[model samples]
Target: MSAPSTPPAADAARRPARGRPPRLDQARTVEAALVLLDESGLDALTMRRLADAVGVQAGALYRHFATKGDLLTAMAERMLADCSTPPPDPDWSGRLTALARRLRTALLAHRDGARVYAGTHSTGAGTLGFAETLIGVLGEAGFGPQEAARTALTVVHYTVGHTLEEQAALQPGDQGPADPERLREAVADAGLPHLTAALPVLTGTDFTAQFEFGLGLLLRGLRGLRRDGSGPGA
Candidate 1:
């Protein structure tokens, strides 16, 4: 009893719809958000924009990120993911120097990367692991837990603050503070003797040298404190 076979076109028409593609997961969403950040800066990285970039509705993002802050924290975590381990150095100062430089490099990689990391407090694996390594280095160098923790925080703050200024001054189309000649002229006009004296080095575009100089100052202070046996728990 072979009934007439249904028409091929009719059979195809009866198939259920495949529907839209699956929504992006949290990691992919963060990745896309980072791309958007690099392209348009943080102000343009709205959730709606990110959703569009991911080919999903804005509400779909809520499934992964509770809020924009949450997404930002995730992005911050991603930025530090590669910095979990400290560089190999014989001494704590050297290790800290390398770690600080690595962090600056990471923050300078994307547009407003330091801004992305500044406010968010991410307890993610990357952030925590980096902190653990820094603290561990300090501890191994004869610093007690309190001193190690405080020293680690001081290093992080200095690195982030320096990178923030560096990124802002170097941003494209930003001619305000980055103009060495203009700054020098202003200092001279203001009759600021000390500033004028230091203008050459201060206005130089040698951020690496400036950063190293500041780091050396901090390490020297720490060493002095250790030597004086005045540091906490010493």
Candidate 2:
């Protein structure tokens, strides 16, 4: 009897079936999640949907990521991976400015990318490396450890918040800024002179210019701190 006939069930267990799904790993799972995020926005990137995209069951995703938050953190890390390279500017301020711009560009690479990044406190290599670069630059500019940390946080908050608004305004079906004429009329009717006067620039969609302007303001303040020796380094 053919060596008692090895059990068919045991043979099947030893080798994967022809059409079985590929093994799911953290990297592949995060990649699939990002694709889903780009195609359908953050609100639509659920684990079930991601699992489907990766040819696996939702439970299988948990084997790689314990929770949806874990997956999102990984996605956030991937978004910042390219930003690890330091800029080549000779001046510290110039380097900081370039780094900030690089950060904005990275966040804008994928749909709802800023939102995804804003939600997670990723301690991954990419995130830590970016933070280290920023702090190192500030240190070279005369900021003490505490001051450098706070300054870094402030700059990051500004960049992320600005990009968040920028992305939200550009979302499909979003009404975007109110029409200039309509906004002026409403502000005039409300007797808000200052708001009426600022409407031209206020309602403008020049995110790049606005970002640069805001960044300049922060840099100017930092310059003041360094000049006056008011920061902790002093």
Deviation (Å) of 135 in candidate 2: 0.5
**Model 1 CA lDDT for position 144:** 92
Candidate number achieving the greatest lDDT relative to the actual structure? 1
| Residue pairs whose backbone atoms clash in candidate 2 | none
Candidate number with greatest TM-score: 2
Q: Write the per-residue lDDT of candidate 1 for residues 52-123, one digit (tens) a residue.
A: 777778998898899999999999999999997867889889998888998898899989999999989999
Candidate 1, after superposition: displacement of residue 210 in Å? Answer: 1.0
Quote the positional error of residue 169 for candidate 1 in Å. Answer: 0.7
Provide TM-scores for the models.
Answer: 0.88, 0.89
After TM-score superposition, what is the CA distance of residue 29 in candidate 2 from its true location, in Å?
1.6
Model 2 Cα shift for residue 205 (angstroms): 0.4
- Model 1: ten consecutive residues of lowest lDDT: 8-17
Q: What TM-score does candidate 1 reach?
A: 0.88
Candidate 2, backbone clash total: 0
**Per-residue alpha-carbon lDDT of candidate 2 for residues 1-234, written as tens digits (9 for 90 to 100):** 557656554233323235967787777668777777877899998988887767777898888788888888899999999887778999999999998998999999999988999879999999999999999998998888999999899989999999999999889976555566778778988999889778878888888999999999999988887788886478
